[model samples]
Structures are given as structure tokens and as C-alpha cells.
Target: MNWLVWALLLCSSAMAQEHRDPTLDHHWDLWKKTYGKQYKEKNEEVARRLIWEKNLKTVTLHNLEHSMGMHSYELGMNHLGDMTSEEVISLMSSLRVPSQWPRNVTYKSDPNQKLPDSMDWREKGCVTEVKYQGACGSCWAFSAVGALEAQVKLKTGKLVSLSAQNLVDCSTAKYGNKGCNGGFMTEAFQYIIDNNGIDSEASYPYKAMDGKCQYDVKNRAATCSRYIELPFGSEEALKEAVANKGPVSVGIDASHSSFFLYKTGVYYDPSCTQKVNHGVLVVGYGNLDGKDYWLVKNSWGLHFGDQGYIRKIGRELSLNLGKQSFIPLILLVRSQCQKEESLVNRRSVYKTFFSCMFAEFFTTFKLKVAILLF
Candidate 1:
């Protein structure tokens, strides 16, 4: 190689480094603002020791968001800027107790059933506002309560916000739940059934931590008899279930760094897995520019994902995650007397038996005499 060519290449490399220094400083400032003092301090150490290649990849992908017009999703540095993929998984992913899933339970419905092209429970005034799970791993509780809230709105003509705190506190190890550490949606449902009902978010409130079960009987607002698990590996069944049965609680692999820093557009992580780690709610499904996507409601606050929602592509199973999704259906009980709908045989009358009192009046001579005597 000529001396002139070598000099030019070295000069270009120097200029590239100079350009990236400002961008790195900008990210450092964002990191300090997003996290608290403790987090900031820990991340400062992590950031300085971060791999150069990873930072470069992040900057490259973010640059491609604007440089490439055909890209479906946008990525940038967010709360997960400093953490590695392993750290993200340890902190965020929390779904557990898959081995305890009930056996002999048959999904009576067909997966091939036709479903509507688009459906959103929020439009029908069933879904509650987006919620944040905070620093705790209480996503299972949030997902459970979200499904219950939707069912309550459907059962009675009232949209009530159920409490995730109730599940976090009450559904302890006794019910096969590990509180904020990790839990299953079905276990939460069973806890609700065993403990009469769950309280409203207004009365109970979310503390985002594990605590003693301080549930008050008077505060009970809604109850569920049982919950069902959708047919494993059947996206069709999941779609149909969400369309007909309000929102369904689902588990996904939210361990990717890109998933953590997701800002907008349809998110499709090729590295996502079907191991079922994070719990979220599936509210609806729709298509965009020939690409079908599931409208997923996340518990990471309004700032995360697409306003706490993500559009998972319909089918582009390149990596191991594939298109297989895990979904569990929770059924709400109208009242106690209403025998828990016959889920076993799939044939039972689910009627609301209401007790009423009435007063009668009569002008007849005999009736008037009896009234006067009484």
C-alpha cells in the first residue's frame, strides 16, 4: 500500500472516533437522568467497562433507523443502555412455575377458527389504563389483574380496575406463587378463587414489593373461579381467544437488549425465545403493510415500547423464538352462587341468580281487611 493511502485511512479513522465521542457523552447524560443515584453509580462503572463492539452495534442500529427507510422498528439507548443481555434477563424476565401447569385440561376450541382482522378491547372500554411494574418482578401480578379487570367490565356493565397488589401479597407460596420474585397467571386465578375475591386498585394499591396478605374482606371487588391455558404452540387459538374472551395473559422472552430499549414501530426480535420469561397481556391483533402483528400491552409504563404496547410480527420465525406464543385464559366468576361454569364438560348453564325483594298492594275488600288487621 502507498504511504498516501495509509495516511488517508488513518485520518478517516481519527475523524470517526472524534464524531463518536460526542454521541457517547450524550448517552452518558441520558443514563444519569433515567436512573436514580444508586443505579447511576452502578451503571457508571458498567458503562466505562462496556465492550466497544456492543456500543458500536447500538450506534450503528440507531443510525440505520433513519438511514434505512424499509426498517420496521427503531432502536436507541434507553434504561437498558449499560446492562448486558444477561443483566437485562436477570432483572426483567420473571415468569416461573411452568412445570406446575395443570394436566388433563383440554382446550375444547379449534385453533383453525376464523378471527376478526382487527380488535382492540380499549375501544370497547374494557381495558384499563397502562400500568408500570416498577423495579420489581411483579409482571405476573400485573398481567393477571389486567385480564381480571377486562373480564369484570364484560361480566357487569362496569369497568373496574383490579389490584395487582392483591395478587402480589396474597398469592404466596401456599398457592404456588413466589410473590414478586416470580409466579404463574393460573396460580393467581386459583388464589382469587380460594380467597373469595380481589380488591380494587383504589383500595389495595400497588406497592411493587412482596408483603403480607393484608386483604380485607370488605375490600373484595372481583373474583374468578378458574383459569385456562391456551393450546400450546397455537397462534391461531391465541388470536381467537383474545377476540372472543377479552384480553389474554401471555408470557414472552423479553430478555433482548433491543427489546428493553424498544421505542417504536413493529418489534420483531430474531433472538427472542419461547422459554416464556416475561408476562404481558395480549389486547388485540392487526395487520400493517402486509405484515400481521399482535398488539401486546406491556407493564413497563407509557415510556416503554409503543406507548407500553408492542406489535409482534405474525410470522417470520427465523431464530429459535419462532412464532410459538404462550397464553393463559382467566375466567371471572360473577358471584358465589353461580356454580363455576362447567369447564370440564363444556356444557353448563351460567346464569346469574339475583335475590330480590318486592312489596305488593291491593284495594280488594279482603286484602284491605287483612292489611288493616295486620
Candidate 2:
């Protein structure tokens, strides 16, 4: 598949329904039985099994290095172990449409205002329970709604579960949000603003697919006045945004293999690039074992990376601001195929649904990034 072009075997994540030491010969049978994985041909199964074994080796080696403290996180096996990188990328990829940048919205960081050194909206009783986006690439709606949910709670003292599916279905027409294919949080936000308000999840519910619009304004549960775009390539700006403001919507290049089986510890990867593809929420920031980290929430389900939460190396994330829509402001802007990427076939493949290589890259550039996508 193309990634739009690379063909390296990669993985996304789903909680493993069946578990057996990969060293066992019956592990494949157990895995197939658990996830109900099926293939049309015996040869196809052989090819996929080879990828699975390779993924096992990748996780083993990474965890071994982690034991020695060479890395911050450990890799694990999941239901997605049998899939290739291309297939995973297509499923997890998110799209963002850059805003026209309303002249009124400005990211003015008040140097005079004293801000908390750390913040976690979850601890403040603002963020709702972690949600699963299932198989749909509807992360844009989740990211936007997650942030809006926090803002609503912080303002009203009632944590309401907003409807992402509302945006997935109704935010399309004039807003250009592509429902399941993908969308931008800014566009999602705009849809909410224009429609007066969005409905609660209890009212609209989420089916994880493109459905007809049934957005009832009477059931409107939350709304945002406007969305702010942080100054690009600055970690400080991101820190302030999360600390001062409520949970903030952000984006990241979640295409690196390191993020696929990510289970715990501060996630960072040297192979990540400035290719933003997913949208997520940044609920807070703090230090962990001497490493500065950002508390991120994903829409991939409670099984993804530490109970649906992951810590990104906050200090060193490359937040590249391309000319695309949201990139200048830490949102997954357009990564329209830059002529197509070259296929990379490596023994230990490093492909992803969202990548971590930019953590190192961001260190030099001092940028901020985040991730999402179902």
C-alpha cells in the first residue's frame, strides 16, 4: 500500500484478546482464534505470520533495551500484530483542513500571568472517561470534542460526554469534515460554532461510521466560542496553552512503528518526521522520572498505550509548521503526499499509525506535537 507509498510491515494497536508467549509454536493459532483473523489463501497467512513473528522480535528487542534503560518505553503484542504498515496507516490516518485564521483569534501568551508548572484536566474532573473510536478514523471529532468537554466542565462544573459522532455526521456539509475518512479539529470546532452547539453523546451516540445527520440543537450539550492556534515550533506555548486553558487539541505524526504497540513510559522516537497525520488531546504536562512529558489521550480505545493515554516527551517534539492549514498551530494540517514516499523494507520495520521519531527532531527545533485518529 502507499502509506501513500511505503510497503514496510507496520502495526496499529488493539488489545490482544488472546495471549501466549510468542515463543510458543501454537501462538499463531491462539492469536488467529482470538481475533478471528482470516485469510483467503494459505500463502497469505504465511506472509502475515512472518510479519507477526517479526513484530514479536521487534517488541522483544525494544523491551530488552528498555530493561537496560536505553529506552523509555516498552513494546507489546496486540491484536493488530498480523497487519502490515500500509493497511494500518490507511485506517488510522486523519485529515485536517487549515483555517483561514480568523483575525480575532491570537495566541498571545501573557508573560505576566502566573501559570501552574503542571496540569492534568483529568485530575481536575474536567475530562470525561477515555472513549474508543472503534474502526473509524474519526479522531478529529474526538479531539475537538474532548477539548470542548473539558472547557464545558471547567466552566459549568459538570463533566458532560459530548458527541463526536455528531461532528462525524453533521460537521461535513459546509465544514468539510470527512466523517470516517478523517477531518480537522478546527473544522469540527467551526461546525460546532456555526450550528449554535453540539449534542451530547447520550443523545446522538457514536456508531463509528458515517451516518446521516440527526443533530438536534435542543440536545446541544457543549460549544466553543473559538479555537486558538499556538505559535508553531515552541514547546513553551503548548505548556501555557494546556496549563492556562483547559485541555487543548493537538496533532502529531503517529506513523512511526514505535507508537504501534506503545504500552508505557515516555514515548519518543528518532525516526519520526514532521508528517502530521493524527489529532489528539493534551490534557496536561509534568515530569516523569526526570523526563518532561505531555499527557495525551487517544481515541483508539482504553487498550491503546497505558489505558488509552500516552506520555509524549514534552520538551522535545518537532512541531513542524508547514504551509498547510493547521500545522502552524500544532494541529494535523495537510501532509498532502509530497510526491509520494519511497518504500522502505527493513528487517525490524519502524512504520506506524502515529510515529515518535519527531521527539528527537523536536528537541533540536523545540516544537510541540500530539496524536489521535481511530
Query: What clash count goes with each model?
Result: 0, 16
TM-score of each: 0.76, 0.75
Q: Which candidate number maximizes lDDT?
A: 2
User: Using TM-score as the measure, which candidate wins?
Assistant: 1
Candidate 1 overall lDDT versus native: 0.66
The deviation in Å at residue 225 for candidate 2 is 1.9
| Per-residue C-alpha lDDT of model 1 across residues 104-192, encoded as one tens digit per residue | 33344555667788888889998898998776678888888889888778766678888898898989878778877788777787788
Worst 10 residues of 1 by lDDT: 355-364
User: Which residue pairs in candidate 1 have backbone atoms (N, alpha carbon, C) closer than 3 angstroms, thus clashing?
Assistant: none
lDDT, candidate 2, residue 99? Answer: 42
